[model samples]
Target chain A: MLDRMKQMQAALDRLPHLRRMGALFSETVLIKVDGQEFYLVFEKGRIAQLLEGPSKKTPYRFSFVTDEDAFEEFWTATPKPGFHDIFAMVKIGRAEIMGDILLLVKNLRFLKEVLALPRARREVVE
Target chain B: MTIEQITGRYLTVEVAGRAQRIYFEEAGQGRPVLCLHTAGSDTRQWRHILNDPAITAENRIIAFDMPWHGKSLPPEGFMQEEYLLSTKAYMETVLAVIGGLELNRPVLAGVSMGGRIALQLAVHHPESFAGFLAIEASDFQPAWYDIDWFHRPDAHGGEMGAALVSTNISPYAPDTERANTLWMFMQSGPGVFRGDLSFYTQDDSLVGQLHRIDTAKTPVHFIVGAYDFTCTPEDARRTAEQVEGATLSVMDEVGHFPMSEYPEAFRPFFVDGLARMPSAGAGAS
Candidate 1:
C-alpha cells in the first residue's frame, strides 16, 4: 500500500495540469485508513510528501478516516456500492471527513485526479 | 434493484424532415414518467431512479438523451462546430421523441436546463404533458462566468469548466457521486456546456410567462437543492408562487444534480415530489 502511495506521487508529478490545479490548494491532508495514517503534503502545485504517520505539530487542513476495505475499494477501477466514494462512505457511517470545506471544493478535480492515479494505472494494466 | 436490472433501447425519430436516433432507458411497469437530463449530461443521471424497484414497480420510467448528447448524435452538418440549444429547437426534438415513442402523456421531469424546458413545455403546450417535476430551474439570470473560459485550449476539454460545475454539487454528497458528476462534465463535447448556458443564463425567460401555465390540465411541482447556488431554493419558491397549483420543496444537503448525486439520498424528495403531483391516469389522453 505504501508502494502504491508512492506510485500515486509519481503519477501526480507527471500530470501536466497538477501545478495549476494545486496552486489553489496547498495543505497537508491526513488520510487515516483504519488507524494507519498517511500525510500528503502539497506545496506549489506538487505533492511534497507521502509520508507514513501523522505530522506531529502541523494541523491537517483536510482529513478522512475509513476502513481498509473502503480504502481499497476507492482505489479500484470499479468499486462496489459502499466503497465507491468518500461522500457515500460518510453517508453509510463507513467513513468520516474533517477539514476546511472551501479548500476541498476549490480543488476537488485536482485532488480527485491525484487520488484516481492508482486506479487509472490498474485499469491500464488489465 | 441494481443498475443491471434496467434495459435500454434506441428510437430513430424524424424532426423537421431530419432523421435522428435518440437513446432512452426504461424500467418497471405502470404510469409513464419521462425524465429529461440537465445540459451536457445524458440519461445516466436517472440510473438510480430506473433501478429502484419501488418506483419501477408502479411507474414505467423513461429517460432519453437529446441530440448531440450521449448516444444521440445530431443530424449531419448541424451542430458540427458549436451546439446552441434554443427553445424552438429543443421543443421540436422533444415533441418528435414523444411522437416517435408514442408515450402516453408521460409525466415530464427534468433538472437544470431540462427543468427550465419542462416549465416552458407546460406553459406553451399544456395538453402535451400530464404533470411536470422541475428540479433546480426557474426564470433567468445574467451569465456569472465567462463562457470563453470553458472553451480555452488550456481548459482540457472542459475539465477546468467542470471545476466550477463541481461546486454546484453539494460538498455533503458522497465522494463517488461527486466524482461521477465531474466525469460527466469532462465527457461533454466542446462548446456544449457553453451552449447550454446560453439557454440557462441568456435565453429561456419565464418571468411574466409563468401565468400562462394551466395547473388544472398540467400541475407543476418544483424540487431545488438547498446547497445549489446557481438555482437557489428561493428561485424555485418565486416561480412556484407565480404559477397556480405549483408546489415548492427544498431538499436538504443536495446541490444541482440531485438525481445523479446520491440517488438513494435523493429518492425520498423525488417520491415526495411525485406525491405532490396529481395522478396521470392510464395513458396520454
Candidate 2:
C-alpha cells in the first residue's frame, strides 16, 4: 500500500498545473490507528514525503479506525442524517486530533479534491 | 487563495439546470474511478483512501461534491425525487467527464449515497464500468426505518442533523479544524437535511435488484464495516448472497466510514480488488 501511494505521488508530480498550484500543500498530517501513527507531507500537490514513528510534527491531525464488519456496514447502509451520528456510533475509539484545526480545515477540501482525481494509467507490464 | 485557485481549475457542470462545482485533480495515467461522497458530506470522505499508496499508484479517481452539497449548488427546484434524478444526472456527467478526459470504462467507487448511485449505474448501464467497489454500501432495506423514532427524536430531523454534523468535529481537533468540517457541512445547507431525509425515508429495495448486476461480466466487490448500525454485516452478507459470485469482505473493528475510520485496513482490500480487475488497462476502445 505504501508503495502504491509513492507511485501515485510520483505520478501527480508530473502534472505541471497541479504541481505548480501546490494542491496537496501541507506541512504534515499525522494519522493514528490503534496506537500507531503515520505522518504525510505534500509538496506541490504530490506526496513529498512520509514518516512512520512514535510521534511527528504537523499543524493538524485526526485518527480513527474500525474493525472489519463495521467498516462494511458504513458503506452499505443508507445515507444517514448527519456526519456525527455516523462517526460516533460507528467509528472505533482509536482516533486523536491535534495541532492547527483551522489549517487542517482550510486544506480539507483541497486534500480531498486531490485524492478524488483519477489514478494514473499504468504501463501495461506484460 | 480563493477556493477555485486553491483546488486548481474548478469545473462547473450543470445537472438538472443547477450549476455544480466539480473539482478535478488529475494524477497518474490510467482508467478513472468516479468517486461519490456520502450524503451531507462532500467529496472529502475520499481523503484517506485517495492518498493511499495503493489507489494513486494504480488507477485514476474522480471525486465530486453531489448536488446541494459541498461547494456545489443545489438544483433550482430541489425535491425528493430530484435526489435520485440528480444521481442519474451525475452518472451521465461522470461518463461525459471520463470521455472528455479520454479514459476508458473506469471502475466506480462510492460510499453511502455514492454507493447507491454506483449501484444504480451498474444495474442500468453495466457496460459503462469495468469494475465496482461499493464500500460499506448495502442493498436498501426497509428494516432500516425500524429504529425507534420517538426515543431517538434526533433520528427524524432538525437538531438530529446538528448532532450528526458535530460528530465529524473531533473534540481533540483544534478549534479551527472542527470549524472547517462544520463549515463544509453547513455550506451544504438545508439541502443536506432534505437529502438525508429522502435517503432515510425512501423505500430503496436495491438489495432486491441484485440480480440485475452482472457479477461475472463486471466484477463487483462489497466492503463493509462489521459493526455498522446502518448497513450491518448481516445486510452486506445478505446482499452478497444475492449477487452470484460477488466478493464480500467484512473488516473487523471498523465502522461505516472505513475510508476515514480505518484507511489502513480498507487500503489492502481496495488495492487487491483493483489489481484483480481484468480490464484494469483496457482504455476506451
Candidate 3:
C-alpha cells in the first residue's frame, strides 16, 4: 500500500499544470488507516517522504483518517457513491478530517489529485 | 465552419425593484423547456443538451444565468454588501424571465438548487408551468456547506471551489471531461458559489413543504444520478416520498454534474424525463 503511495510523487511530476499549481506547497499529511498512522511529507508539490508512525513528536498540517475497508474501497478504480471521494466518505461517517481546513482547501487541487493516485488509471480531468 | 443553432440575448427585468439584465440562450423551435442551472454555475451547464438535435428537434431549450451569476452582473451597489440568494428572489427571477420571454407554460427543468426550486415553482405557481423536471434535486440537505472553507481570504475560491465540487463528479469520467466541469467552478466569482449554497442548504429547504407540490396540476419528475454524493439517490428518494404523485428515476454510473461530466450517459435519462413532461410534443422526434 505504501508503495502505491510512493508512486504519487512521480505521477504528479508528469502533470506540469498541477505541479506548477502546488510548486510552493510543502507540508506533512497524516493518514490514519484504521488504528495505524502514516505521515506523508510533501515538498514542492511532490511527496518527498513517507513515514509510518506510532510516534508523537512529528506534527501534521492535516489528517485524513479512515478505517481499512473504506480506504481499500476509496482507492478502487471506480468507487461507489459514498466510497468515491474523501468528502463522500466524510458524508457517510466512514472517515474523519482534522486540522487546518484552510491549508487543505488551499492545496486541495494538488492534494486531492495526489491522494487519488492509487487508482488503476488516471485521466487528469483537466 | 459549423454554425450551431444557439444564440444569446439579454433582457432587462425588474426584480425586487432592482433592474436585472438577464442573459439567456435559445435553440430549436417547439414547446418550451426552460433550463435552470445548478448553484454556482451559469447557463453553460446546459451546453450539450441545448445543442443536441435529439432534444432541440422536439423542444425549444432556453437557459438563463441568474442575477450575480455568469454574465448577469450584480445590480448596483458596486461592492458594498454580501450576496445571498433567497427562495423568493430565485422564484421571482424565474417568473420574470418567463414573463419577459412570453413563454406559455413551459416545462421547468432545474438541477441542484435549481432542482429544489422546482418544488417551490410547483407549489407557488402550479398554473404557470406545464411540468417540472428536477435533476439531482432533493427537499433539503443539512450541513452540506461550509462558507469559510472556500470564501476566506487565505483560500483561493476558484481552486477550492473546483477541487471541492470535484468530489461530486463520477470517477468513470475521463480526465478531460471532468476537467471541463472543474473549469466552471474555477471561473466562479468570490463567494458566489457559497452564496448560492445559502439557498440550497438553507433558505429554500422544502422539508415539510414538498408534499405541497401539486403534481396533479403539473407533473413533478426527478431524474438523479447514482454518483451524486451531495444529493444522493437516497436523498431524491426521500424527497419523492414526501411529494404525492411525484416520480423519480435514478440513473446508474452518473454523478452530480451529469451533463458536463458525461453527457452521453445523461442524454437517455434526460430524453426519458422530457417525454414524461406535459409539454412533450407529439412523442419522441
Provide the interface RMSD of candidate 2 in angstroms, 1 decimal place: 12.7
What value of lDDT does candidate 3 attain over all alpha carbons? Answer: 0.84
The deviation in Å at residue B230 for candidate 2 is: 0.8
User: lDDT tens string, model 2, A1-126?
Assistant: 345345446667677765654554656665443444456676656677766656644443543333323322322322222222334433334223455543443444344334323333223322
- The sequence of per-residue lDDT tens digits that candidate 1 reaches over residues B1-285 is 623778889999887787888999999887778899987778888888998889888888999998877888776886446677888778788888888878778888989888988988998887878889999988775565556556645445467557766646764577778788777877877777777877788884666998999887788889998766678787788888889888888887688899998686689989987776656583357
Off by more than 4 A, model 1: A1-44, A47-108, A111-126, B1-3, B280-284
Q: What is the interface RMSD of each candidate, in Å?
A: 8.5, 12.7, 1.2
- What TM-score does the predicted chain A of each candidate obtain versus native chain A? 0.84, 0.49, 0.87
Give the worst 10-residue stretch by lDDT in candidate 1 chain B: B148-157
Whole-model Cα lDDT of every candidate shown, in order: 0.77, 0.55, 0.84
All candidates: CA RMSD (Å) = 9.6, 15.8, 2.9
Better of 2 and 3 by DockQ: 3
Best by DockQ: 3
Question: What CAPRI class is candidate 2?
Answer: incorrect
Q: Could you tell me the lDDT of residue B194 within candidate 3?
A: 85
lDDT tens digits by residue: candidate 3, B174-216: 6677888888888888888888887777773567887777777
Error of 1 at B169 (Å): 1.1
Ranking by lDDT: 3, 1, 2
